[model samples]
Target: MGDILVDRQEMKKKVEKFKANGPSEPLDNIELKNPFPVMLKEDMMKMADAHKQQHHNFVQKLKSRSNERLEIPLKQNSKIDSNFDELANMSLDSDDFKKVSGCYHINIDAKLHEELCSKFYLKKSPPMSVTKYLERVNRLLCPSTASLLTAAYFLFNTVFNLKPSNMTCVVPLEAPPEDEGEIQMSPVNSRNIFRLILGCLRLSLKLIEDKNYKQRYYCKVVGMQNMPEMLRLELAEMFMLDSHLFINQYVLTRFIFQFKVFDHNVRLLFASMK
Candidate 1:
C-alpha cells in the first residue's frame, strides 16, 4: 500500500512539471484565440473602393453642371407699349429740371442750337431754320430727344429773353473769317450725341421750377418754346459745327455731370430740403 501511494505522488509531480514547462499548444481546428490572423484587409479594400467611387462621382457631377447660360434677343415676343404714359409719369422732369436751368443759362454760355442739331441729322442747305430743323428732329428722333431740344429752347429764351426766328444756322454768306490766333472752343451739340449731359441736366432742373409749367403746356412754351429769334439763329449755328463730340460730351456724360458739376454744398442743401 505504501508503494501504491508513492507512485501516485510521483505522477502528480510529473503533471506539475509538465504545466511549468510551457503554455499548452492550441489544437489545429479549435484555436484558443483565432491566431489565423485578425486582419480586416477585405473590409479595408471595400472602404478604399467606396472612397474612390465617391470622388469620381463628384468630379462627373461638376463637369456636367459648368457654364450653362442662355441669352434672349430684344424686340422679340415682348409687348410693353406705353412710352407716352411712361414719360408722363416720370420723376426725371420733376425737380431736376429746375436745378440745371438756374445754373448755366443765367450766364450766356447756353449751348442750345448746337444741343438740337446734334440730335438730328440736318441738311446744311442755305435756308436752314429752327422750325425746319425741329420738323426733321420731331420726325426722326425719339420723344426724349425732342424733349431735350425743347428744353434747350426755353432755356435760351428765359435766361437771355430771346424769341425764335428763321435764320441760316451757317455763318452768313460773306461773314468775316475767324482770326488765325483766335480759336473757337464751342460746346458739344448733337441731338443723338450728348455732350456735357451734366450741362443739359442743369438746364432741365431750371426749366421745371414753375408749378403750372406742365399743366397748360406752359413748360413746353416757357421751357422749350418762346426763344428770342436771335438766340434761335445762334443755336442753328452751334448745331452746324460738330455732331460726334456733341454726343459724347453731352448725352453720354449727362449722368456723370450730375455728380461731377454740382457743388457738394448744393447737393447737401437739396438733400436737406428733401
Candidate 2:
C-alpha cells in the first residue's frame, strides 16, 4: 500500500509539473553524431571505375554454355526454349530472366562481340564491307528500330551459332538440308545478304510486334517485283529457324550491345579500306 501511494505521488508530481510548464517537449535540433565518411571526387571516380571493372569481370565469367561452369542454371525455374534445332544452345531464360514477372539486367562479354565482328568480316569479298552492305540494306528496307535490332540479334546468333541459332536463309534449299529434322543453314554473304535481311526484318517485325506488314507490303517497300521470291525467302527463314523466333529483352539488349560494336567495327574497316 505504501509503494502504490509512492507511485501515485510521483505520477501526480509529473502531472503537476506538466500543468505548470505546459508540457516539456524534447528538442531535436542538436547535431551530436560524428561526420559520416565521405569520398573525394577523385576517389569516387576511381570507385566508379572499380565497380565497372567488377561488372566486366562478372560478365566475363558468363561465356561458356555449361550451367555448372556458370553456376547459374540457364533454365532456373524457366521454360525450355521451343527451338527444335539440335545445334541451338542459346537460352535468354526469359522466364527466369524476368523473375516474378519483372525484367532484370544482363551483360555482354567483349569476346562475344569480337567474334560477331570477326565472323561478319570473315565471309565477305574485298571492297564489299559490312558497312556498305548494311547501308544498302537500311536504304532498301527502311526498317523500324525494333526490327533492325532484332535482325541484328538474329545475325549475331546465326554467325556464332553460339546462342540460339538466328540462321535465316533467304535462299530456298534445293536439296534436303538434313537427314532428319535437324536445321541446316547456309552462311551469310553478299549474294544473299539482301534476301537474308529482308526475311529477318520481316520475321522479326512479326515476332516482336502485334501489327506487321504483309507480304505485298514488304515487296512494295523493298521495290521488289517478285512477291513469290519474297514469300519463299520469308518461309525459308522461318523453316530454317524451325519457327523458333522468340526474343526476350535480355537477348535483345545483349545483341544491341554486340550490334553496336559490329556497326562501329564495320565502319572502321570501311574507313581503313579507303
lDDT tens readout by residue for model 2, 33-82:
22112334468889888976775454444433324431223343222222
| Model 2 residue pairs with clashes | 90-164
Whole-model lDDT, model 1: 0.34
Question: What residue runs in model 2 are displaced by over 4 Å at the alpha carbon?
Answer: 1-142, 165-187, 211-214, 260-274
Worst lDDT window (10 residues) for model 2? 168-177
lDDT of 1 by residue, 210-265 (tens): 22223224224322333343244344433332211122112212222332443476
lDDT, residue 236, model 2: 60
Question: How many residue pairs clash in all the candidates, one count each?
Answer: 38, 1
Tell how far residue 223 is off in model 2, in angstroms. Answer: 4.0
Name the regions of candidate 1 deviating beyond 4 angstroms: 1-142, 145-233, 236-245, 249-251, 254-264, 269-274
